[model samples]
Target: MASTSKVALITGGAAGIGYAVAAMLATKGWLVNIVDIDQEKGVVAASIGATFYKADVRDYHSLRNAFDDTMKRHSRLDFVFANAGITDPRNFYEAQTSTLPPEPSLALLDINLKGAVTCTYLAQYYFRLCKQGSQLADFDPTLVIMSSIAGLEVYSPIPLYTAAKHGLVAFARAIATPFKESDGIRVSCICPGPVFTEKRKPSDADRLDMVPMETVCNVVSELISPGGGFGRCLRVLSTGISDV
Candidate 1:
């Protein structure tokens, strides 16, 4: 909790890419706040020297409370990682047996696209406050949105997931310019191809050209750097990163 240390709030930081980023930041002496629905992972966050708050990203109030608590404790916010998201559980195009068509599950959309939007709003509000209180001229706050390769291309297996990811890419690009000009907030999207995370099985690694989590984390680190450009969509592959 040094006065000069930066603070970062990450959604779904209990596991996967979010957890990776949280650990990296904590190691770099950042005051990291992890907001997630998994209470049991609180110990995991502590193990990495990060504070964990149990909350669902889909619940706006709960998520906002997490943000409020972070500001209350740290008195400043520098970065926000809107990384909470889930893949579609079932095929959305599958035929239903009922007389009338059943409603397809929107849980993925709610958590991925809608959750990121909520995080963006809160980040902007808090970032403005940070800028108002700071004296430095280069206080560049950043918000990194997590997207997928499905966002840029057609992933035929899960149409709903693809749609949700596409929305995230579009949303991040749409607000990057205004946010930078008005609040000095750097907004960017990271769309990685077939990442090897907790959600993926061991056998699938043999078939998929999966991108390493470390590579993705490196890209995130670069995007949040003070010199990072705004409104850029980076596509990470097994080989390297490129502009979308």
Candidate 2:
């Protein structure tokens, strides 16, 4: 490992895009911490040299404990990936049925929008707190959030997922400037189109339109690099990437 290798924390890192990001960082020699609700994959994460903490992003206490454990293990935290999220197969309209009439799932909002928000808030807090004992550098630490192309444009079928992703994009943009000026913490977002992660069921057409998982990880690597800019929204497509 490099002498100056950094530490990174990724939420929902047990599988899919989160797991890919964790592996990318690990290969680069970063001390990666994987936080997710799945205990089984958490063990797999540990096997790959990442410290795994079973955490549900929706719960503040659960998240805090994970953060605390990460801090205890590592002296400093240089990057955070607020990537935990989920979507219901049923949209709001489809959820209404004459028979059992399932209540609209707040699970989407809770885990997607609110959970990302909570992770961002706590990340900033810990970044500042941990830096208090030492002099801060002009630039280094970064927060790369996982938004989606659904955030930039609307997708009607999954209204709830679209809404939550839109919230993440707005949240990243709104705080970018302030975090840069006040804390020297770079904030950026990645908006990928129809990524073929395990949680998503993509059709043939969707796969054609989808960006590669590696492409999304590269965007995050760019954001975490020292020369990276603040307030950038990177959108990935099957063709390539664009800064929006």
Provide the lDDT at 234 for model 1. 96
lDDT of 2 by residue, 10-30 (tens): 999989899999999999899
Where in model 2 is the C-alpha error above 4 Å?
A: 1-4, 95-102, 135-139, 198-206
Can you list the residue pairs that collide in candidate 1?
none
> Number of backbone collisions per candidate, in order?
0, 0
lDDT by residue (tens digit), candidate 1, 1-244 = 3247889999999999999999999999999999999999888899998989999989989999999988888878989999999878897677789999877678888999999999999999988877785775546799999999998999888998899999999999999999989888999999999888877898867755888888999999999887789898999999789988
lDDT of 1: 0.90
Q: Compute each candidate's TM-score over C-alphas.
A: 0.95, 0.91
The residue-level lDDT of candidate 2 at 192 comes to: 89
Quote the positional error of residue 146 for candidate 1 in Å: 0.2
Worst 10 residues of 2 by lDDT: 130-139
